[model samples]
Target: MYPKMLEVAKSEGNKEAERSFHHANEVEKIHAQLYQKLLDNPGASRETYAYYVCPVCGYTSEKEPPDSCPVCGTKGKMFKKMD
Candidate 1:
């Protein structure tokens, strides 16, 4: 879906749409990889950690948030804590 959207955005010459689709696509790929890693180690001990989500680009991080979001460059203060 993201790839299709990205292509559509590109074809339409919509830079903002293209960027959004591209970022979402890349983030989804990262999420899949993280899920795969967890599946590969089903018996590993789990640790609790606070999660922070970037409101601007949906970037997620455990423990502490980055100084600036790698996805959209949003400031750390803009991130919301996920309870």
Candidate 2:
């Protein structure tokens, strides 16, 4: 769905839509991979750390946020922290 939206956005020359849909598609792929990893290791130890999400692109990071969002170039300071 997101990939299709990205392609449509690109075809229509909507830069903002393209970026947003592309970011969502990429993030969903990462989420699937992480979910698979957890499923493969059900007993993995859980560690406590701050989780940060990019307000513009939905990019997620643990421990600390990046200096800049790799997806949408949003500044680290703009990230929303999750408890």
Question: On residues 1-83, what C-alpha lDDT tens digit does candidate 2 reach at each position?
Answer: 77777778889999988876766778887677767866887774265557798998788876688999887789999999986
lDDT of each structure? 0.80, 0.79
- For each of the candidates, the C-alpha root-mean-square deviation to the true structure, in angstroms, is 2.0, 2.5
* C-alpha lDDT (0 to 100) for residue 54 of candidate 2: 91
Question: Per-prediction TM-score, please?
Answer: 0.78, 0.69
Q: What TM-score does structure 1 among the candidates reach?
A: 0.78
Global Cα lDDT for candidate 1: 0.80
Clashing pairs in 2: none
Residue-by-residue lDDT tens digits, candidate 1, 1-83: 77888888899999998887888886777667767866997764285557798897788876788999887799998899975
lDDT of residue 41 for candidate 2: 76
Candidate 1 ranges beyond 4 A from true positions: 43-46
